[model samples]
Target: MLPPELPPLPALTRAEGELIDRYLEVLDLLGRINPARNSGTYTGLRAAQALVTKAAALRDALTVMHNRGESELHGETLARALRVLDGERRAGLVTVPPPADN
Candidate 1:
């Protein structure tokens, strides 16, 4: 069966798009590094190492936006964009999971 069509991405400025993309990348790395979620130290360590680079990229994205005079954040619009990009699920992975039942 054909999968349902995904919603179109919300309109965003170039910097905003970069910011979202970089932010998601960082979230993915964080999720992998999350001790509660990760099973192995080596895996988490690798993610932690990669996180430094991803975080720098995220910072650069924001810096570009700031330099471009995009001072105020459009929270509602960006929230929509994040939702479209599955930010909630990605971000959730960074959190500690619930305790297992006995």
Candidate 2:
């Protein structure tokens, strides 16, 4: 995730918050999945297990970035968060470009 602005608020809209919430839910689902299952039902879980790593990384990065001053984040660092958010959408954990315009 990109380094958050110095204040670390990120000015997220409600839609953006919802998207983040969805991604969290997906991550939770992945956490619930077990790696030892030998059945086909475990396939998606296995996939989730692998994919959740990205989400976990994003979560950690965001936590760190948010601790920074609001003005500290710019360009490349901010881009990283955008990329991770996009990855969340691509992974079907969240929706992209939120429906309502901010």
Candidate 2 residue-wise lDDT, 1-102, digit = tens? 986644333555444444455555555455344333224566666666666665765565556546543334354544444455553434443222235666
Per-model lDDT:
0.93, 0.49
Tens digits of per-residue lDDT for model 1, 15-40: 99999999999999999989998999
Clashing pairs in 2: 2-81, 5-69, 5-70, 6-69, 6-70, 6-71, 7-70
lDDT of 1 at 54: 92
Give model 2 RMSD, 1 decimal: 13.2
Residue ranges of candidate 1 with Cα displaced over 4 Å: none
All candidates' TM-scores? 0.96, 0.30
Best by TM-score: 1
* Best model per lDDT: 1
Candidate 2's TM-score: 0.30
Count backbone clashes in candidate 2. Answer: 7
At residue 1, candidate 2 shows an lDDT of 90
